[model samples]
Target: MKKILLGFIIMLSTLAYSQNELATSYAEKGRTLVMEKKYQEAVESFDKAIAINPKSALVFHHRGLAKANLKDDSGAILDYNVSIKLDDTDFEVFYNRGVSKYYLKDIESAIKDFDKSISLKSDFANSYLFRGYSYIELQKYSEAVKDLDKGLQLNPKSGSGYINRAIAHIMIGKNKEALDDADKSILYNPDDIRGYNIRGQAKAILEDYKSALEDFTEVINKKPDDAKAFFNRMAVRLNLEDKQGACSDYKMLKNLGEKPNSEMEEYCK
Candidate 1:
């Protein structure tokens, strides 16, 4: 009887271990899929993992990421809250939940989460960047610049930090500083089409139509199908009295069915 009981106990232990192993395997696969942008498949894998181990906080965190990628921010936040409940000290959970809250326009709650994340991981540059952006949205540009400066100190290679800092500068009428940061952003990421667009806007503000036109033309070259690029370039060309170029883009806009009104006729004429 003793030996029979011992054998049963070992069998149950092995089964339990097998279930945990399966759950971990599925969770890992789901995380990989999420990173690969195969978010729908990732959710399916996470569901299987959850079926095996419903109480896993890390699995919930990864599944939340997949849900957020699919634009299911509420679902993602629910999972993130569960994960935070299970492990409140997780910096990533706070940061990701903060992002979801920010998108949902819960700016105060998002700031609190970002604060938690930064408290947990002081060197988290991305958290600073996001927090700075939130501050900018709230019109606290000075505070935003402080956070962005810290982010730049922590991550010198971050082109987005430069771009956002440039925006803050522009908001405060620091045209020279804004121009410098915009140039740095382009230097860091030449292929970033938005960088050119923002730089062109800055040049336009400075009344440098020649340089503005060049920058906008580069943006259009990189992204031919971008409607904003065509629209912006047309405005700059109009300023320069480049009627031929402006009319050409108007025709392109017409072919794209972008303009519903007769404004193109008025502009081109």
Candidate 2:
């Protein structure tokens, strides 16, 4: 009887080991599919892994990533919630869930998740960057500046971080600081139109109409159909006492399906 019991125990252990191996294989396949951008297929592979091992937090996390890539923010959040319940120690899971929440416009919840992620991994620059964006959306400019500044300190090459910081500075009426950040952003990514736009706005705020006009004109040269750039340039032109130039920009703005401001309407006519 003892020998028979030992044989049965060994058989059960072997079966469990095999099951775990199969689940791991499926999970690896899912990761490969995700890298290939085959998000739907990746989800199916993760599903098979989960079916074999429902306790696998890693599988659930991978499924959440696949869902996020497919733009299924709600579905991703669901899978991320399950993953977190299974294993709350992974900072990446919280960060990914925060991103999904951000896409869904659940800004407050996203900030909480980002806060948790930062708590788990204090050096995580992206968490700070995204949290700063959330603060900006909430119009907490000072808080946004603090987070963005920290993120940039961690990663000085981040153009998006500089751009966001510039925006926060602009909101607080610190146009000189905004101009500096915009210049840094443009230096990092010359093709980014927002950098030029922010710089122009900052210059305009400082009453540097000539430089502001040049910046706006540069934006128009890069993107000919940009109505906002035309409008900005028009305002600068009016400041420079160039009525003809302002009137031409006003016409272009209308052609781009954007209504001119009342001031522009009265002045241009």
Candidate 3:
């Protein structure tokens, strides 16, 4: 009887090890699918892994990532919650959860998650960026500036960070500071039209109509169908006393399916 019990115990141990190995294999395959952008397939693979090893935080985290890629932010949050419950030490999981919450428009909760992520990893620049964005959404421009400044300091080449910081500056009526950040954003990523748009807005606010017109025109040159660019250029032309050019731009904006505002209507008329 003792010999039989020993053999059975050995068999169970072997089976458990095999199951763990299988789970690990499935999890690895899920990660590969995620990398390929096959998010749905990756979730399926992760499902199989979870069935084999329900305790695996890594599998849950990868499944959350796959769900996030598919734009199922709530579902991703669920997986992230499970992963966090299993292992709260991973800064990545907290950051990703913050992103998922942001997509769900839960800005306050997202900020908390970002705060947790930053606390875990102080040098994580993206955490600061997202937290700053959440502050912007909350209309806390000063807080946004502080976080964005920290993020930019950590990653000077981040064009998105510069653009967002520029927006914060603009919100606070710091037009010159906004323009400087916009210039840095363009220097880092020339193809990003947002930089030009922000720069144009800043210049217009500063009463530099000619330079504003030039910046808006540059955006229009890159994106001809951009109604906002046309609208901005129209406003800049109005400031420059170019009534005809302003009317023409207003017409182009209308052609692009954007309704002219009341002021635009009066000006164009």
Per-model RMSD to reference: 3.2, 2.0, 1.6
Cα distance off (Å), candidate 3, residue 191? 2.8
Which portions of model 2 show Cα errors greater than 4 Å? Answer: 1-8, 260-266
What's the lDDT of the predicted structure labeled candidate 3? 0.95
Candidate 2: global Cα-lDDT?
Answer: 0.95
What is the lDDT, from 0 to 100, of the residue 142 in candidate 2? 100
* Of 1 and 3, the candidate ranking higher by lDDT: 3
**Residue 20's C-alpha lDDT in candidate 2?**
93
Q: Each model's TM-score, in the order given?
A: 0.83, 0.91, 0.94
Better candidate by lDDT, 1 or 2: 2
* lDDT per residue as tens, model 1, 76-175: 9999999998889899999999999889988888889999999999999989988988888788888889999999899988788888888898898887
Per-model CA lDDT versus the true structure: 0.89, 0.95, 0.95
Query: Candidate 3 — worst ten consecutive residues by lDDT sum?
Result: 259-268
lDDT tens digits by residue: candidate 3, 1-269: 99999999999999999999999999999999999999999999999999999999989999999999999999999999999999999999999999999889999999999999999999999999999989999999999999999999999999999999999999999989999999999999999999999999999998998999989999999999998899889888877889999999988988899875788788777
lDDT of 1 at 268: 64
Candidate 1 — which residues are off by over 4 angstroms? 1-10, 225-231, 238-269
